[model samples]
Target: MKQQTKTSKNPWVWIPTLYFAEGIPYVIVMTVSVIMYKRFGLSNTDIALYTSWLYLPWVIKPFWSPFVDILKTKRWWIVLMQLFIGAGLAGIALTLPTPFYFKASLAFFWLLAFSSATHDIAADGFYMLALDDSQQSFFVGIRSTFYRLAMITGQGLLIILAGALEIMTGSDPMYVNVTTSPTEQVDYNFENIPEDLSNIDELTFVVYPKNVTINTNKISTDSLSSLKEFAREHNTKNGFIALSETEKLKKNRLDGGETWWSHNISTPLANAIVKNFGVKKEVITKTTDDKVGNAKLVAVRLNKQPEEDKEIVLNTGFAKGDKSISIGSGERLVFNSMNWNVPAYILVQLDPKLEGVTSASFKGISGNIPLAWSITFFIMAGFFILIFVYHRFVLPRPASDHGSAANSPSDILHEFGITFVSFFKKRGIFIAILFMLLYRLGEALLVKLSSPFLLDIKEFGGLGLTTGEVGFVYGTVGVISLTVGGILGGIAVNKKGLKYWLWPMVLAITLPNLAYLYLSTYMPESMILINTAVALEQFGYGFGFTAYMMYMIYFSEGKHKTAHYAICTGFMALGMMLPGMVAGWIQELIGYQHFFILVILCAIPTFLVIPFLKVDPDFGKKDK
Candidate 1:
């Protein structure tokens, strides 16, 4: 008779809880780190460098995994790690400041990474201890499905939530315009201004100055009069005039060869003239030829210095004042008061070089309907496609049926023991670890150095993307491309053996890094180019990463396969961390362009790993 065996009362009970614990902390640390850095106003290089340090706990987790196995039960480790992660997240939320939320958030993320790494070790070990070979075989699919769902929840849902919060609160966009000089000049051209203002009824004028002062009648007039009289004796026409309507005499008078007085007086001495004079007019004429027949004539009073041979023409639009005067050809009007009437539009023409001056319209996202809708539709369609592929193709296949051999309690234990011992003995295990360590070196370097290089206004190292724009490109477009690349890579690997596709994977990965080189070199002002470059690089990374995972699986063969794979992942984390720690310092030393070149140079070691990898002959073969 067959031996009676005790089984889990409910196999699926722990699925959601375990996966949720696994996913949240990992996503918060690994994926959201980029967003946090961007929010904190760090350059790409700085963010990459700093956050990459967070990978340290993950990289060294393998060294600790064995101890977990030897020491207390897996359940204890899992529960404890989960609690730790929750605490870390809560701590981060508490520490986050209104101003520096991103940096504080990242601090908590690092804590989460540490906790999550420990959780991963215990959870994986617990799976082995809890399930027999047959149950393990059947349930592995369930576990992976939940794990993927967790990734989607963490990366997709959480990231989207963060983005929505960023947009609503204006947190990301706040850092865009950096503090610089008090006045940052941007050129504007008045090309659309009507050239011919020949015909019109009432011309309204408004004048504004770069700097303005309001001289209220606050000071005593006697003191001002005495100072002005003294200045006039010194040939300086500066003084205050005080006269009531009854005290002032209105008549045609000339003092400086220009029109000095007018007969028609609206208010006595209200508009008085002193010495300097100028005139500008917007004339309306009745022309039978065209419906909009009108012109604006701008007149000027040429002020010539008597002692010097220089002539300075002070135009009607020169000193800020407004007047509506009707003038025929060669008609002249004079004012006795010092107040000169200038047209409003002449303010922009004061300096010949100041040609560009125009107000900009604020049309929101909805204004660009087609482009916005196109992007929205594309993103939605991509997500749907992913859902379909994941559910229809990837979900149905069980690990045991697809090259995983251990299928019963005895088989799992035997395999585990053999693999566990082989992990210490085999040269391949060490090599695999080394390969994982080297795999992400280039990516790490790129992240660590790209921002400082691009933002170096002094030197040519970066594209100088705005904070919001960079977030859009990297967080949104980059994420999409990464998803697509991962999906494609998975499909490719599943269809063709990793050995046959090694060179293509290498090329795909390395070539995309070159996009960064190009982008860093020609830091384009256009948002489209920036988004495209980010997408391409991320897509390549996604594709290459799929190959890396497959290689780990291939290397983790024989006994204790899951443990070996976990060990490899630790090295992978290390590869990211080591480069990140030194990225900022290196960027400061070598600069951005050269640093990116160095990133490219690091790829050589990654490609070198490809030659040593042995592809499984029956890589994609199904078990009968």
Candidate 2:
């Protein structure tokens, strides 16, 4: 009997895992990181800006894809890049808890991103090398299904897991409360105080001269004293006291009470403390003396802790008669109060901008990520380890002229040049590239901001969904709808041909975006409504995107078809990157409702450009 070739090994064992591996890091780097940054309290602008840059490798992967075929065997590149990806993921986990995590994690993310892109090239090339054309066509659907399952794993399950971890590991911030003793007659003063209060331990009160003007433009102390008196008399009657700075003005109230001024007084007080004392400052006040007999200064101090410590101390001054605040160990008080109202407490995040005062908590919106992150990373690393092992042992190598490409770099460079030149030489190539970019413009913008919109407050025109809910809607329900739509689209195209189905596919993609418009407009909290809308939109996107993809394949039918298709995808990435980078900024500018409307308007180009493109009448028909 003839010896069995390694290439004869079952494609089933490797194809699923190969595509699954290909997808996880891409989703993590692209979509998951966006959600992570949002939770980390990064502004939408920054989240869009930094995370959008991660698409760079994919956008330029075609340039390097030719080299993967030239340099080493596809199997070698796939396994090696997978190893690098695993290491990069572990690196992200290691750096997540550090003070410089944003920088460090992003660096690792960049590494993982590049490696994942290379793996795409290698794994895809390897698939072609190992399988005959018939097998290639046969396993395509299996590979795609597995790839999408990876999407649900990363986008849905991992997100839900992270959200659950957040709830499980999350703790309420420890606030420092200042309570007044009925017997003690505490005097009020605001004068020169040391900037660095981190050294002071226990309750140490620093009294300043009462009614002495803050004497600087930074803080109008005269106005603040008047506001304090006004708040004591008005209580909850004044609307300004109940609103945040942004809300107060929008309510159309003519009275600019002390409540309005005092709500924003913390920033100036912080500035004054920083300027005069050369240290960071926190301003916690009792604007309303409601239940508290009289306003008194109760000074609480912060003890010195290790530099790496992440304990948060809030200087929260509440009015008298409120419940006592509780805190965890390692947490110290700087001051305390009960029944605290808006403008009543001004807690400034002081930056001691000095060498001795490194104790300021950098606790952002998400505060600190739970220790559970390490576990999540380890699990990911384990998955990669298993993948690496399976591929090394079970995968068969393909015979090729690998040594020729490996030895001669110049030949690879020459082929890349020819590949680029020949791609543009195709008929209607300009229009083909135009359609590639425009077809998905609206979808590109939508994908970038969709998660942010879901997590945003309903008042801001978003769905106000939790991270886990978003994962559920997008990952499970939405992805399934997408897959079903894609399958149906393929079947339909096979029966009627792409030309006959083109318009319907276009409608499928563009019209479903209105689901977002409806959600943004209505701001429904119901999961059923949200899921249905998301599923509908995703199904449309999947169906429409099939046409876009098929058109690329159809357009890239001549010589150098592979390289030309790669170039087309490069434009596709570019289309997503350019809009995604700006979508958040645009959403921030226009709010979610208008942003969704804008997305709908963006689809106009897709409709307008259909006439300019060429499609084979029987391209996708079975008889063809």
Candidate 3:
């Protein structure tokens, strides 16, 4: 009564589900983990550098793929890898509450990444063996559709679910309303200063002068000088990384293993890249004029001591209204028993062009980050367990699903070595590798930093979007628009050819970088505006990306095409990884605005390499 006798062996019953399962772990390892790390309290630099390395599994998956043939039946590998994936998810969930959660969870993610990469190899192999040639063609699109659905589920629905849980598990959100008027500023004076609230025992925001006025045009030298001095003197400590935590990070990062190499070698190289190619350092000049933006102070303090074990992390940003009025600093804040009563100041500033009277509310939410993410991963783990069980029974037993005829592991390695050598020895292989690596340089730089940009507070130059809002922007709308763009791009390429569409596709991908540049420069408060910007950028990326994919298919057309294509993907991932590792480090040095500007500049390399690429006139054309 507890178990059913048999499950259906129909391709309908398994192809979609198997591919869906395959996509889930890939998306989780590649994209979802970046968002999870952000919500879990990792600095962007660490998140990008570490997660980009996760690509190592996929980058080298081609190297080990043939081994999947010798080790076990593709069916066996599929079921076993699903089980391993479930174990990885469970491991992450379990370690999330521990003191060294970051390191421990990353280890589990590696397990997930490796298992998923193997699963990709096995699942794709099984598809061919299980179905007839005609059936394979019929289900190819179906498998891709389900795979994409898996991406949306992992990125969109899963993220929204986590965000909701974060709210449900935390305290009621707090909102602080502030206003700026051109006529309401007071001159520099001791009388305007507020009382010290350090002795008071209470948890509340101490927003002084609900209506703040400043001179947008010009201000007296003495008054400007006084406010600047005060802001410098009372600067709030960073909310995300404390001095102690930062030192610990440096120590841990440099201690040993791969990190030792990263700290000494990769870190310096990345810094060098940033220094040479990133935004120029500021050069101060003597001037009779003053800074156009004016600043004011707002404070937050705890009324009572918090529980010793709990750390309250408060992230603040503009809720709505004029974008010109913004928090210049103190976007992220942390308070605990040790600093319960002392007031932390947030510096507010007005854009020099902000004219007339306008009002805006800055909202802050303090959530229990670890618990929220812990629950998310635990649920995923449980879901994977169910998937493992279902696949164990449901997947069809194909005739071709068997280990290699050769008995020796050495034989398998030898064949793999041949495939690798053949791939490397292809004509114009160097050019092909360079094209794969450089094609998406700008996107590589942008992808690793986008989540951090969306999630960071307004004071730090992010859009101040919530997790759900961000999920909606990228996971939902971005994906949908991307699909449409890809479909359109395919149609256009089919009508003409890859050679004809190459420049347009490249432009489509590279030009939309300006959307991000515009958003960061203006820092708009509207969610709709943010969504539109992201959609435009993603759509362009999807359209332009058609060329990159076509080029890969084109390049992989010779003997050992399938294996060569896999190697091409490895090179593609390497391209993304190298640029991504440095993205966050550079973004932190320069703000988002300049970071995006540099991203736009990266397109020059893409264009520079274009003349070297050769594609047949009829490559993607239907007539071919």
Candidate 4:
């Protein structure tokens, strides 16, 4: 009767929201932040480096768990930390648009990371305090389900929304008209107009349109420029013009005149004139502006002229026989102007002496992606706001004893030292620590680079998946498989015990990495193929991770069982952080294909350490 009375209240009210809150900040700080930084134009090295530092709060959290236990009631810590996390999120949104946004926002993320880690300690402790053993067991799956839902919201819906918003904020393509001033006949002569441009004696006098995208947004211009430079360095500058040789030749034949030679010009510039200016005849004389706006005659050249021979007699116009337009056999005609004129003609005076040099390139206008990113921050801030309000009113505040275990600063330091020393003193402690560190070495490197490889352009040896596609494939499909695998792993370990399943779990975790290697090698464009591959890798990770958790539980047996488990988790976090910090730099150096091959090689350490580690035959089994 007494036990039934104690558990009379419904468990549904708080468990779902409690676990959901716990998951949001973690996903935000860890996974969402990685994607956000990539879209913000940070180098992979910087993204991996700084974001890895955010894990410090979790790595050293064991040192602070004792403080949460002794200093206040668990309910107090949970509520207070939620509010703190909420404020930190708002701060991130506020700092995103500032000049020092990277440094400023990282500082706020640090605050959120620390608060979230402390909240984990409080939330777990409170779970034990608030419910009886039966109630706790019944609600475990419910809490897990809600937690995964939060992961979907953070990783899937949020990312998809941001991607959609990016399209909304995208700048329209800017059009600039390019024209040549010297429309009249020049001094140079070429009687043999070769059908094939490759046969041209001296390909001279080229006029092509280059898209000069000037980002009017003050906040993102610098980052975009840096990204452009990085892209150029990596050789992913979006491939040259969008015209085929046949199209150019067909247009030249249809036009038929002085401007017919324009077909031999670069594809991008010629295509733009045809599409934008709508020049029906080869000569563009007195045609309506149509889509053509103000023109800039930036430069014109008959051919490469010697420094001494190069002349700019701009005082005279192209009226009949002007000395300003000098098109000699050896002398290259040159002109420069920043003015617009009606019915602009792109006249090319080809000299047989020159090698027929004509080329121009066009690039799409780069958009302000940060505008969308900044809006994402604000949206997250609002999400935290709703969480704060709900938790403030609805969450039950359980009563408990609040006492300070350490009265002074020295006492606190001494407690921390003792806690560290006790873990190190356990039997087989060194080997156990090595097993924990090496178990997921390959996974740590692979997770950090996964998003980057997906987002990179196909030309750069990446999958070139869009943000929404990546969100769906990895966040929706991959996470679903991971959860299913974890559930099955638990059932398998419970039936046969950890010792029997240890080696199989290790293989499950390490072998699926080959999927990533294959994807990078083939560079598959089909979404179905990419999603299938990602799902395989994630399912393996989820299933294999169960053994790692079971080992920690097995090793944490003793007088200070809870404290030992916390210490074990710290080592797990360290394993992820250390390798992740350098993963990006390595990927950047060797590229994705070789980098994944290297990831497969890292599996050796994982397998090598497993044989030496001890596990109890009946560790995870229930006594019937």
Q: Estimate each model's TM-score.
A: 0.54, 0.71, 0.85, 0.70
- Please report, as a residue range, the 10-residue window in candidate 1 with the lowest summed lDDT: 171-180
Q: Over 4 Å off in model 4, which ranges?
A: 1-9, 173-367, 405-417
Top TM-score model: 3
Off by over 4 Å in 1: 1-17, 41-50, 70-76, 98-110, 126-421, 428-434, 448-476, 525-528, 620-624
- Candidate 2 segments whose C-alpha is farther than 4 A from its true place: 1-4, 172-374, 401-403, 406-408
Task: Compose the digit string of candidate 1's lDDT tens values, residues 1-624.
Answer: 212123323456665456655765676576555554443334454566667778888877766665566556566566566656656655565545324455665677777788888888777766665555777789876786566565565545554554444334321110001111213433323343344343433221111222222111122334333433343222212111122121233322323222334345422223432111111122222224322211122222212111122111111211112111111121111211242232112111111111222221110110111122223223433443343243232222122211223255576566556755777686665567667878777887776554344333322244543334444565567767877897788778777767666778777777788877777667565668867877898899889888788888777776667678877777777777877876654554344555667788888887777677666755742320
In each prediction, how many residue pairs overlap at the backbone (N, C-alpha, C within less than 3 A)? 29, 10, 4, 8
Better of 3 and 4 by TM-score: 3
What is the Cα-based lDDT of residue 1 in candidate 2? 30
Candidate 4, RMSD to the unseen true structure: 18.2
For candidate 4, write residues 225-261 as lDDT tens digits.
Answer: 3433443332221211112233434655676742534
Number of the top-ranking candidate, with lDDT as the measure: 3
CA error at residue 600 for candidate 3, angstroms = 2.1
**True lDDT of residue 420, candidate 3:** 78
| CA lDDT, candidate 1, residue 59 | 76
